[model samples]
Target: MWDSRTPGIPDELFERTEEVPITKEDVRALVISKLRLREGQSAIDVGCGSGSITVELCLQTRGEVHAIDFDQNAIELTKKNLKKFGVSAHVVQGKAQDVLPELPQVDAVVVGGTWGDAGKVIELAVGRLKKGGRIVIDTILIETMYHALAKVSELQLADIDVTQVTIAKARKVTTGTMMLARNPVLLISATKP
Candidate 1:
C-alpha cells in the first residue's frame, strides 16, 4: 500500500498550531544524519506528529516503520502526510507507553514529542530495542531533558549526547533595521548496549 508516491495516512490526525511543523526536508536530513538508517532496519517514531519523520523513515530505510501518536487529529495528519509523500508506514493511534508493549523489537526509536510520560516511554522504548539499537528524543523543556538523561543513564546506554539547536531568522524591525528571531530545540541521543 505504501510506495514512493503513495502517502499512507488517515483522516483524523491531530493538529498543532503552536509548534513549527516538521517538513519533508527536515525528516530526510534528520534520518540521514542522526539515524543513519540502513536498509532492512526497523524504526518506530513515538508521538509522531503529521508523519513528517515517519514518512522519511519509510523512504530512507527499506525497513518497516511504526508511527504512533495519542492525538487522533495528529494521527490523521500523519496518515495524510505519509500518503502525500508516497511512502508507506504503519500509523498507530494510541499513547506510546501503552503501545510499546505490543510492538516487536526495533533497530531505532525516535520520540518526537513526549506527552508527559517521557521517562516511562523511554524505558519501554529502550527495552523493546535490539541490542546496540539507537534512541533519539527531542524536548523543549529542560525538565524533560533532564528526565531523559537520567533514564538513559539508568538504562546504561552508551555514547549519550545532548545537543541544543538554535535557529535564528531576521525580521524587519524597520526599513533599515532588522531583529533576529530565535527558536531552540534540545536533542538527546543514546545507544543501547
Candidate 2:
C-alpha cells in the first residue's frame, strides 16, 4: 500500500495566486504512483488545473508532458508552478478534446478534471496512446467514473483497475486532534492492449 501522507513535492511550493483548482498533494501522490511512469516516456494531462499534477509529472518523468486546460488562468497557473519547480511542459489553453489531436503519441495520460467530457477525452486519449500505454483518470463524480469505465472497456483496454479512495486527516482541536474527511476520489486506470 502506498501512503500519500507525504508527497515528493511539498504543497507549500505552489503559489495559488489565482482562483483555480489544484490537486491535493496526497491525491497527486497516488495518481503518480498508479501511472507507473517511466523515464523518457511522453505523457499528457487533460484538465491540468493548477498544474499540480503537471509539475509532478514533469519531476517524475524525463518524457514530454502536454498540459491542457480550457481555462486560461489555469494554464497560466500551471506555467507558474512549472517555472517555480524549474520543470517544463507544453501548456495549452484550450479544451482537451480539441487540442489532444495535435499532441504527439504518448505513453501515459492523466485525466484529472474532464469537465463533463470524460468520455470524449478518454476515447480520444486512448486512440492517441501507444500500445502498452496507460490511462489514469481521477473523478469525484460517480457518473464520470462510470463513463470512464464504460469507455475504457469499450475501447478494449486491458488491465483495467478502479479504486475509490476515502482519505481523512487528523486536525488539531483545542485539546486533541479530530478526524477531518476529505472528499473521496475514484481512480480508474487501464492499459492499451
Candidate 3:
C-alpha cells in the first residue's frame, strides 16, 4: 500500500490505476537542489515514471526536459501528469540503454530507474553528458549504491558524493500512543570530468 500523504499524485493519475513501485519526494528534492539547474541547459530524466521528477525538472530549469520510460502504463501516467502539471516536456517510451544513444548530449541526467542495468545506463549517460555535466542517481539498496560508486570510479568523475536520506513519520499505534516510521533512500551524484 502507498502512503496517502506522499505528494505528486493527482486524481487523474488514479484513473489509469497502475501501481508505481516507488515514489521518493526526497529524491526529487535532492535532484533539484543538487543539480543547481540553469536556464538554457538540456536535461534528461531516465526511467521517468509518472513524469513527477521530469515535470519538476522542466519547471525548475529553463532547458528542455526529456522524459523516458519503458513501461506503457508508466509512459501514459507520465504524460498525464505532465499535462496536468502544465509543464512542457518531451516524453519518450523506450529502454534507457537503447534510447539514450539517440538523443543529443545533455547537461544533466537523472536516473529514476535503470531496470538493473545501472552500469550500462550510467556509462551511456555519462558519455552523453557535456564536459562538467552532472549525473544524479537514486538507489534504494546497498548493491545499487555500490554499483553507482563503481561506475563513478570507472568514469573518473571529478567529484562524487553518496548521501543517505531517512524520513520518519509519526504513526498511531493505539489510543494516545504513537510510533515513529522511517523510510530510507540512497542518492549518488557525480560530475563528468
Best-performing candidate as measured by lDDT: 2
Candidate 2: regions farther than 4 A off = 1-8
- Per-residue error for 56 in candidate 1, Å, reads 1.4
lDDT of 3 by residue, 95-163 (tens): 999999988889899886888988899898888899989998886777778888898898899778888
lDDT per model vs. reference: 0.74, 0.86, 0.77
Q: How well is each residue in 1-193 modelled by candidate 2, as lDDT tens digits?
A: 1123234566677867547988778888888888888878889999999898988888778679999999989988999888887889999988888999999899899998777988899998887799999889998999999899899988988999999989888899999999999999999988998
Candidate 1 residue lDDT tens string, 150-171: 9999888998888877655557
Report RMSD (Å) for each prediction in the order shown: 5.1, 3.3, 4.6
lDDT for 164 in candidate 1 is 78
Error of 1 at 73 (Å): 0.6
TM-score of each: 0.82, 0.93, 0.85
TM-score of 3: 0.85
Report how far residue 124 has shifted in candidate 1, in Å: 0.6
